[model samples]
Target: MPKSKNKFGKYLLIFWGLFITPFLLLIIIMFMASKGWIGEQLPSFEELENPKSNLASEVISSDQNVLGKYYVENRTNIHYYDLSQNVVNALKATEDIRFEDHSGIDPKGLLRAVFRAGKAGGGSTITQQLAKNLFHEKPDTKTERVIQKLQEWIIAIQLERRYTKEEIIAMYLNTVEFSSNAYGIKSASRTYFNQTPDSLSVQEAAVLIGMLQAPTRFNPARNPDRALARRNIVLSQMNKYDFISDEHIDSIIALPIELNFQVEDHNFGLATYFRESLRNDLLKWCKEHINNATGKPYNLYTDGLKIYTTIDSRMQRYAEEAMREHMTEIQKKFTEHWKNKEPWEDHREILEEGKKRSDRYIRMKAAGASTKQIDSAFAAKTKMQLFSWKGDIDTIISPMDSIKYFKKMLQLGFMSMEPQSGYIRAWVGGNDYRYFQYDHVKEGKRQVGSTFKPFLYTLAMQEGYSPCYKIPNIRVTFDLPTGDQWSPVNADGKYGGMLTLKEGLAESVNAISAYLMKQFGPQAMIEIARKMGITSPIDPVPAICLGTPDVSVFEMVGAYSTFANKGVWTQPIYLTRIEDKNGNILQEFVPRKVEAISEETAYLMLSLMQGVVQFGTGGRLRGQYKLGMPIAGKTGTTQNQSDGWFMGITPELVSGCWVGCEDRLVHFRTLELGQGARTAMPIWALYMQKLYADKSLNLYKGDFEAPKDPLNVILDCDKYVQPGDNKTSFDRDF
Candidate 1:
């Protein structure tokens, strides 16, 4: 009996040893991991102070509006103060309920997760999740997962020791990826709601908090039903935790998820073309200028440089609004006129041009794709998003057919600038940036038509010609350097009499323009235009007087602004300054100025252009908009009614606009529907009407300043008698 008792005792002792030995070994391994003795090297204190996350550089408007950002992660850090209480409560209720009670690792939650196989709740606290987000990459294997879990625990404890709960939460929100290229709460808020985090309501906060689980699966814009259900679940959790009242939950849940989805992509935001152009400028600036902290060139993708531009948000809005308003009506008229006829003169040529411009064509060419395959791809119908006057629509269409549709659609470019300072105030590059990547305001070069006549008239004034300078309004033959006879006829086809330069220009008599060009010569005119900021290559030809040279709206506005600035031409300045992330000034931009023409000559030219708005083709400014300001402008119509241009100037502002199809071959059949007065002038009038109404804009409504010295030009024809007539001829030229 003694031997049997000893054996039983030995068996019991062995059983106790077997159970306790493995538990002791597990404790030792965990302790080693906690002290950085196991797995990968953890982030040190210095690393924790400055986390490795991509920061976006911002483009801010002059009015302090955040235009957009350039980033790899699309992340912008916000302080704890920027977060609303509702967002905090929603995050706490959905992510970690006992967040305030835990010291980073919640033992109670861990045991609960173990009992329920992670179905009831997650064991990792906010700090642990933040630790995983900040310090560790996602593990691939089961063994790697175990090691990562140990690392998370250690890092969570370190985080608890280093920062407060609020700071940890803000840091967590700032570092977590919300999918769709959005990183951090600030970016997520802007991406989903088009508003800041501080402006988020309880329902909005709940929606964002719910997205934390699976951003792609529950994206509010894409999956409204799933997003709504998840948001309601978050709301219920908040209600159960007393974060919100039951009555509030009931009311909030009833409301549908409203998403103002404005994509902040490179081609989606306001002034997208302008922003794209500015990015190139910044890229060059960064390469030239070195960062103070790193002693290296700034990376626009990573460095949080703040680009302060001269664009006014209000004026930009007005410009876009006016374009949409007038272009829609103008397009309707054009479509009606071409109901039976094909819009393009050479559809095949336009299609080939469009195919050359396509990315697929370029890539396929690079990859050595066969001609048949390329043609098949272009002809095949595929899903696409198309821009309409109403709104964007999704449809299935062939790429070639889409290009044809775009060619039929009339597009426009409008830009406004300060005459004196050269600051570009408003820029509308095209009808839509997504559909049209070509920036007409800066890149497009179409025939200026009668708009170029003003430059010739400016040359005339410099050569001692006046507003009252009489010229024959008859067909004139110019002996060209090419040894060809160049004779121009009037648009009205009525020639034979004398008219003042002002009357000829106002009526846009083509014969008079050619006669003046014959007399003054194109070389002198090109020199004056060059000094006035026309950067395009102008040919010294007789036909150039009839506005044959193709010029961009950017160059036209710069030249027109010279007249507005009392003859001092200042090159258009887009960027005002660039500051580093730490508010250190890196560079400041100044206007490039040159004396293009005399003050008296510029004012005399203004006197001639004012005749156009008052009594000639641009009378729509007075008839339609009733803008009674001291406004001077010109209307242009290229041959075959391809391009329509309007350049309007006031005491403070000068705006230039162009309206036409993507391809010059596609145009209205007649002057009734295709004239500059009908197409581009209305956009200028509408934009100016909006500008005049907005008192905050402070745009001068007064007339152009007269020359400081008395000019020997006849500006008003109220009492002047013609040199050959006994009675003053009151008959207008047109």
Candidate 2:
């Protein structure tokens, strides 16, 4: 009996060695692989602790709204709490039914996957899937693939040990791709439903979870039918797992995937132009500033920065709406103004010049095409989407005609800023950013027209000239260095009356402006303008006072803000602060302040400009819009009515607007429809009206504040004013 027992024990030892030895060997191999001691490289322990992800940098508005993002992957991470219970449950039910019970790997599912050769399931737990994504690489050989699978299992176990189940799931959701350039659940939720992750409904959660299987095949926006079917499958799984009741799932699957789809794109959204402009600025800033942790320059696209800007979402909406409203009206009138005759017909040279500047022409030229070939390309009709006031128009048109169409179409730039802080509240760079890539606010340099007068007038105020300073409306000729005479032509060509300086500016009298220009030569005008924040080069020609030089809307707005800011030129700034991914404040920006003029001079200029809105060219602000606020403004109409500009100021805000065709040659024949007061001022009025209606903004409606000290200079012309006592005081009397 002892011999028989010994034989059985020997046989048992043999059986244990036959099975357990290879299993232990496999375990050892996997352990070595996890430690990077085997077939394929795996993430190190530290790397596993914090997985790499390409996160988008966000642009947040002053109201805490996300204006847009700069990204290679449009991803923003959220903690476990930011995800709704619906998403969590849906994930577990569909992807891993025994998620809570498993420690990285499930024994039954793994055995099923092995014996059935993955026909039943891949048996990849959520943690394993996350491990694959965290350290993704392609295997060239089947042997490498098998080793990679082993490495994934070991890495999954490590992740499970290092993090809680909730953290594992959160990381999985945060790093997964959801198509449409949207990586991670937060961006997916906002891109599909325009909602936060925590606000997703059960159906929405199910839809997003279903997309994880195959993002493109089940994209809600692109493949709604497949997405709906997949979503129902997820819901059915939820019912099987008892996460959702049978009755609940029946109703849930019956519901279609209702998506408010908006692709996360730099060319689409609230502030496309501003985001593009900020991207350029941030690129420079990143080069200048380095990241302390990595000892490298910051990456604007991948570093996951939070740029807090001064833009107000509400105000941006209003500004965009105002542009669309007024631009449509003026464009229609302009079309009718030159109904039969093209504005550029007499100057086909201008058309030829513009045609050469086109992308088609440039491409053809680069391809070594002859001039005739380039012309042929332009004249060839193709399917294209043209920008229109109503909406984008899909049509078959020649590229040349497309250019002409856009050339005839109007473009504009509008911006509003807080004068005291120089915080930009709203900026609309063009009619449509996708079609017109130029940013008129910062990048575009065009004739400012009569908007340039403020700088000269500022000099007049500094030289002790009061608002009541009078001059005759006569042709003031300048003796040119070329031995010729130069004189400005008034629109009406009527010059006789003696008008006050305030009246002359309000009326935008060319002769009076030329008279002032002669007194203070172009040199002094340039000096005052530079001090007022005009960065553009100013020509010292006498014609500069007539707005001949080109300047940007950004410079104009910043220069005009000096008056409202009580003579301090606060540089217009967009960003308030920048933060890292972890919400650590990296840098804060403050507006640069410079004393451009005296408080008294600024006040006097305000009084003179106020007459513009009260009775001069900008009188439409009072008559048409009936804006009750005490406003100071100027109206500018460039040569041939090519460009129209309105510079307006209130106590709290300084706003500017410019309207023109793409080519300076394309313009209205009549000043009535194209003048600054008619074209540009209407937009400002409409924007201000909306701003005032929204009482939450609390824009100042009161009159401009006077100087703190006693006024040494006079504004009242009727008083014993040296300029126009009226022989009585117009400044005080008004």
TM-score, structure 2 vs. true: 0.94
TM-score between candidate 1 and the true structure? 0.87
- Show model 2 residue runs off by greater than 4 Å: 1-40, 720-734
* lDDT score, candidate 1: 0.86
Q: List the residue pairs that clash in candidate 2.
A: 716-731, 717-730, 717-731, 718-728, 718-729, 718-730, 719-728, 719-729
Full-model lDDT for every candidate: 0.86, 0.88
TM-scores, each model vs. reference: 0.87, 0.94
Q: What's the CA error at residue 196 for candidate 2, in Å? A: 1.3
Give the number of the best model, judged by TM-score. Answer: 2
